[model samples]
Target: MGNSSSSLKVCTDHQGGINWLSLSPDGQWLLTGSEDGTARLWSTADSQCRGHFQGHESYITFCHLENEAAFTCSADHTIRKWDVMTGQCLAVYRGHTSIVNRILVSKDYLFSGSYDRTARCWSVDKEKPIQEFRGHRNCVLTLALYSSQDLLQDSEEEESEEEKLSKDFLVTGSTDCTVKVWWVSSGRCHQTLLGHTGAILCLILDAPNRELFSGSTDYTIRTWNIVTGEQLRVFKEHQGSIICLELVNRRLYSGSTDRTVKCWLADTGERVRTFKTHKHSVSALKYHAGILFTGSGDACARAFNTKTGILQRVFRGHKLVINCIQIHNELLYTASHDGTLRIWDIRPLCKRGKRRLKKERSLQGRSSQKGSLSRLFNNKVGCVVHQEDGREQETVELM
Candidate 1:
């Protein structure tokens, strides 16, 4: 694969490092939070700054974008809602005594996790917090929400009166190495998941399957049944800290500080393949169609084929580590600690032609051989024979 920086567009107006990026639901606008204490809105079509949101007293830690509004949380110990088109601050939410790390907006309720070791639920129209979840002993790093309807339906057993009356469930993961499930209606923690020996860095919810996956500095990914808070499975192949995770079609993709990205069969906890092209820790991951896009500490973003574990393209130009990535309208957007947001057209790289077709056929042939051998030879010690490039090869193996 070759570097594709020539076709990249750079947006370098931010004076400080970008900490987070959020793409709007329609994919027409992008919002970025930075160390400069401001969040700006940009047009993805032309890479132009459409609105500049100001007024945060400290650097922004995270941001979320909606249809007509933007939400940003900062070290200023507050979260602010802004009108996306006009760039006007609509409301300021203040309650956290420390830095606000993440914000999630669901319906009319806004949920925020902070360094205060608390996650709070706030009314969108009101500036005050409606409920506070105060069990985590360390900074809250990630947040996810499960709808009330889904939670009720997924329970194999009858729900309690309190659970039936709950609005929704808010999930929080923290530096304390725990994941807490809270009822949004009562501000009470329903369950505390404890298994990771290190800080929880990221979380992704597989709601349809009633599962929650958490990645941690413990170098493992753990799955839990959200309904019962029962530990389901653990994926422990990574040699370093797990930084990010993406779930697509029951397949779990995890990026790690081991400088590799792994693909797993989500339901079975089976390791499918590994992509080892990254030169440094894989910090961010995004899955679109059949391609896996990654941002790494090497200051480069790469595209890989999920099926064959082949590197398709390399994006280089960022001067520092890439912090986040988003894909929209055939373009890939990357925000970096280098104080710039870069966008690249990924349409050309996504096309499958003669070369890719040939590779797929070769991979299929090898896969068939492996499947046949696995079914026929049940012995722990055996000689495995396979054909590659028209040559026969034999290898001795131990189970």
Candidate 2:
């Protein structure tokens, strides 16, 4: 299939590389954090920069949006909340003695993980830590939250059981090459999942399916049963390190230093397709519905078909490699390596129709013998091609 990089449009410009991006849960705004020590809020419809907050002293690593307020974690060793409408600093939660790598938010609590080998849970409203979870031996790279429903079903019920028992759980992946699941309320360790040979970069839970996926620097993606702590499968084919992963439907999507994104069947562990979207290492990926968005060291953000493995669009405006991308509603937010966060009005671009593949001419030579024809019988050869509309194009060639 012919590649079409020009079909994509650039919506905005950010001089620095982005670090992290998130869309407001209400679907009204977008937020981004960057190495420039700033985070910005943008209007979803027009991609207008509504406001920018510049209180962090170092590179901002992560951002989470809750209601109308946004929270950010930075190498400056601080976490700050900002007003989405006016970009005003609402509160700063600071206590970590080292650079913070990641952050997670629930309805009532904010969790921050750092290189100091600790994770702290804070009150979202009061903006203070209520509990400190300390045990890991290295930098915490990622954290995932499990719903209360998961805990309720996992525990054995008692005769005098409390119906509305408080339940909260968090999973953290670290450079220590382990994934730890913890009880947030009691600050207790639930389970430690050990498998990867290198540092774990990302961990995600498909709570609906009771599956956990982890991407690591060991060049593999490992799937595990969250309840049983059993290793389900390991996908290992990349030539370099695997950095990020996202799952949609029953397929698993992963990005690697091999400069490619590969799709795999979650149930069979079979490789479905592979696409080279960036020239450098892919750092992050986000998938919503059927569209896949990726950020990489190539200084670009790209959109590709999740099924057919076709590169549909290439967004080039960041001065350095993009670190993160998140789409909420119709707006796309990208964080880059240079230090700035950029927002785009992607509603128009997101409405792309299905891709059409060029039909291939079939060979017309016929078999001489009836027995030969029966032995060499071939059905229509069809290949699934990627189109911009987030659907596959089946090109069938008759022989």
Candidate 3:
């Protein structure tokens, strides 16, 4: 791998592998859930640990960060909310009978999917679940939220009675090879999408487009019409299980155990480009300012040009797989199974490369899109109910 170790900053405090990572909306803080049975908050400005949240009896599986609080789910079958500054445990959401796989926070509610084979919605102010989604036949591996407000914003025409009465929806993907859409207001199963033949691994929603993209162990990515329960498209180029998916500007990017990343046109299902530089499974993906950043089981993160399909830089140093990645303010944050969060100064290196690419494109008479590569300096799960013998088995869970 190409070396860029001189610009890297490592935060080594977690005792076990970091499973998940979340960035505060303001881009000032980062929250990481770890196999150490705790979650910690760090400052993005200085790479300093700001708060340490400890209370779970088992390893944390996932985490989400908000303005005032940090939420973490664990193998202990509980979800805890912590104050961002004080690190005090505020509330414990206890109801799942098995491991909680993922959590999503929207407006005033929290949604969780678990190995318990159900997804539940909770009021942020309450301790118990306000609604239980109980239809999945296997572990609920991933969760996503779509607000009806987005539909309202997308349409200027008069709303129908159904549209007027529609509440926000919660989408869950499971090991049962199914995707369920539930009404957040009534806890009713709005739609059950069936197509995949293997476990669903990751999900991403294009709310404005009313489309849902799901990556699966079946080695395919499928698109669905969330409102009509219709299968729209299937992208089946990956040679191994599809692990992660990212959508920006109607372009879809997927990483797989095939040790490659592929880009596709979301509307047309056309494969645009392939990035095959990774030596192991591509575990995570993040896109910022026209650059695609990928983390892999090879313990390295890399940056690639979206338009030209060029490998720009490779970040190496981690001793284990990188679990998740986040980019903000020209700094790249990578969480890994090495039990460390490493931040890289991506500013100096990428700026010069981006300028050169822009000049080349201009000379070729090529125009950039609204959020294309020419704009630089931009700052920006799994199922199964099987029980293990000794310690809980570690799996890849990303958000």
Candidate 4:
């Protein structure tokens, strides 16, 4: 209903909407996959469109940036590796029976989920899949890594384990209404969590709390024990599909097709607050530095206070829906249906208005309780600063 205070700076305009965004671990550049059948790299500092890697014949659904290299999955049913600095397609890995919807990487291996209803594990360098994991009955919509605890527990049971348990396992959610955890190394299914009556839209692992949270088209959010495959709780407040769930510290933030952002107790299924921040369906959500960033089909990325649920700043830079948002260091990056990516100076916003408001109010009190509002708000209170002077010593809260 009101104009957004923060301004948007466009970084690049591709031929199609950017679907997913990833930042290089060093934070030097950004990698994005789009429906244009390509992945592009942009310089973080200058906002320059550096290079584009093109090979996929269809929409690129996801991409992951690692150092100077990147990996992408596409609706074309293939995964391609690229040299980020040059934008050259270095290698192509093809084996999926349908569109590759997601791609994930560990230290040495790559994992992918597809519309073909199978998840595959591949060797990153050789571009060869070592094993195919088949269990889900429908499209694998989302994939997430599990906790070290689950991985260790699964390994202890095998008399002779072929899978070298990485520090984490993997969770794959599908349209068949099930979430499955797999042994990363052995490509074996560990647990299958079922309850949702509709398609699973998102799957997230809160390793610190040892729990998994999922959003679904069934208009519910479900929590489960990652190790035991036990259904912990179900939150049925949203009237529409819960498209995205953000876990900051312990607080659970969910964006929904109902055009609202709901805050909940991460560990328990208790509702804390509900606030409307978008004109239409909230397609994506991200919370960082005391700010909740949400992108909507209304063609804007809006920021709100994590604790107060008050509007902080609205960034309107795209002409179409924003699909995903990721924050790195001082910059906020967004991928949009307008076929472009943009970056903003988060320090300016986080250090000035709403950020200062958060520190002054102490809105988030201290608590170790999992999913408490305190952990959600206080975790992003910005970096504290202490200054010394000759006349008098004083402390200034910059953010």
Q: Each model's C-alpha lDDT?
A: 0.89, 0.75, 0.87, 0.80
Tell me each candidate's TM-score: 0.87, 0.80, 0.86, 0.85
Q: Per-residue lDDT for 226-335 in model 4, tens only? A: 76778999998999999999887677888999999898877677887887858899998887767788999998888887656778778876889999888877678888
Better of 3 and 4 by lDDT: 3
lDDT digits (tens) for residues 53-87 of candidate 2 = 88888878888887688999999899998887778
Q: Taking the tens digit of each residue's C-alpha lDDT, what string does model 3 give over 1-399? A: 345554468899999999999999999899999999989999988889999999999999999999899999999999999999899999999999999999999878899999999999988877768999999999999999887777435444564566468668889999999999887777888789999999999999998898999999999999998767789999999999999999987889999999999999898899989998899999999987668999999998998888777888889889999999998888989999999999888886568666865665564443323223323323222322243211121110000
Q: What digit string (tens of lDDT, one per residue) describes model 1 on residues 45-135?
A: 7889999999999999999999899999999999999999899999999989999999999989999999999999999988878999999
The better candidate by lDDT, 2 or 3, is 3
Give me candidate 1's TM-score against the actual structure: 0.87
Give, for candidate 2, the lowest lDDT window spanning 10 residues.
390-399
Root-mean-square deviation of candidate 1 = 6.7
Give lDDT for model 4: 0.80
Clashes of 3: 1
On TM-score, the leading prediction is 1
RMSD of 3: 12.7
lDDT of 1: 0.89
Residue 317 shift from truth in candidate 3, angstroms? 0.2
